[model samples]
Target: MTDRTLYIVVCGAPLASRVGDGVRQARDRGWSPYVIPTDAALPWLEDQDLGGAPVITGNRKLGESRRTPKADAVVVAPLTFNSLNAWANGNATTYPLTTLCAALGSRTPTVAVPFAKHDLAAHPAWLASLAVLRYAGVAVVDPHDGSAVSLEPITSGTGDAVTQAFEWDWALDRL
Candidate 1:
């Protein structure tokens, strides 16, 4: 594999169930991929096979050394409404959030694919948070098609279909 390290920050969403696809895709591209899932995402990953990519959860103890290597790039796929808002506001209340904040602060190349229901996306806070992330130079992509130029909300009942069609190349290609 190449010397590049790709950190895939997964959130709680239907799309998260397909994280194994991303891990395999990253490895095939010659990059070492790591999964950093939000606590809520744990259940989704239970049935996934992430190849050999390590899943990093919880924060390290004060004296503990870092577990994963420094990231060459980061992909936050299926970024939920809650996590997206928290990350945009710089709230590192959780391990996944902390990782996202650090990646943004360090200027690490990052691509985020937001997966929110249409109703949630209609909230004023949704667009505001997205704007905040865009201002921070994070590439915001549409999980439906990996379009960086626009982000559309997922229809309430279409999550499963959308997730099935999602490809890791969407986020990876952006990086």
Candidate 2:
């Protein structure tokens, strides 16, 4: 197995399941998974073992965490629209956003799975932010597509959507 560690960052409750799935996928493929969550996700993170991976909180430590030597890639699952906007605008106001910014700045391969309502998804600001992220070399996985399966409703966490986020192998291909 390679020494590379994949960092999984969850920004909210719903994303914890996605991160868990990602970790399982990574482990099944013989890769190491490191879990991290923002303050907003603390409640959920606390409930999970995350396969014994270290979980860091707060923005002050995020930059340092991103620079961890074994890191190979970073996955921001269930990335909220607010966090996405913050990251796109280079406004690292929170830990997850700060870690993402640090990862990008350090040339770490990062992928974001954005889960939002159709209206918010279609907003011009969101589109602009996505464009900025793409131009900056950050891959934004639009969970709206049928490719990534969703564990909850796409509209309000009550309706189901296809879960088709890129698998670990596909993600590695982008790197």
Candidate 3:
């Protein structure tokens, strides 16, 4: 196995059911994956096994001891707009996902594949936060176009389109 371990953080999104697919994809590509879930995304991981990757969640206290040591990268799949805003505004410690995002900071190569509705993506604060994060060196990617996918309105995404838009390869490329 490669020395690269990907910490895949899952947030609450409709496509969260496919998180296992993300883990499998990462592993197949030679990076071991540790699936960490936000509280809202916990159900999607219910009764599922992610090879040997820890599903750390439950208020972020689930697997501190078992974390993939020095994960070469962090990929937040299905990153919700709320987490984006919070992470941008120094609200990191408030929730599990944001806490990890904040703690990892710019030290770790982090990629965020956002999944949000059109309206949330259009908010000024959302736009500003994304820009700020990018400036701070976080790779905030859009799942749909393989582009930065900043705070602008996503033109073609909904349902399966949204699911299909998740760019697994692009995420790894950023790291």
The best candidate by lDDT is 1
Mind giving the per-residue lDDT tens digits that candidate 1 earns over 1-175?
4799999999999999999999998988988999999988999999889997899999999999999999999999889999999999999999899999999999999999999998999999999999999999999989888888989999989999999999889888989
| lDDT measured at residue 156 in model 1 versus the true structure, 0 to 100 | 84
Worst 10 residues of 3 by lDDT: 150-159
Clashing pairs in 3: none
Clashes of each: 0, 10, 0
Across residues 105-140, which tens digit of lDDT does each residue of candidate 2 receive? 887888777766666767778878877877888776
Please give the lDDT score at residue 25 for candidate 3: 79
Candidates 1 and 3 compared: the better one by lDDT is: 1
Across 68-171, the per-residue lDDT of candidate 3 in tens digits comes to 46667788877788888887777765445554565457477788877778788778787787887687778877676668654334454564676765657777
lDDT order of candidates, best first? 1, 3, 2
lDDT for position 152 in model 3: 36
> In model 1, which runs have C-alpha deviations exceeding 4 angstroms?
none
Local error of candidate 3 at residue 25 (angstroms): 1.9
Candidate 2 TM-score, C-alpha based? 0.77
Record all residue pairs in model 1 with backbone atoms less than 3 Å apart, i.e. clashing: none
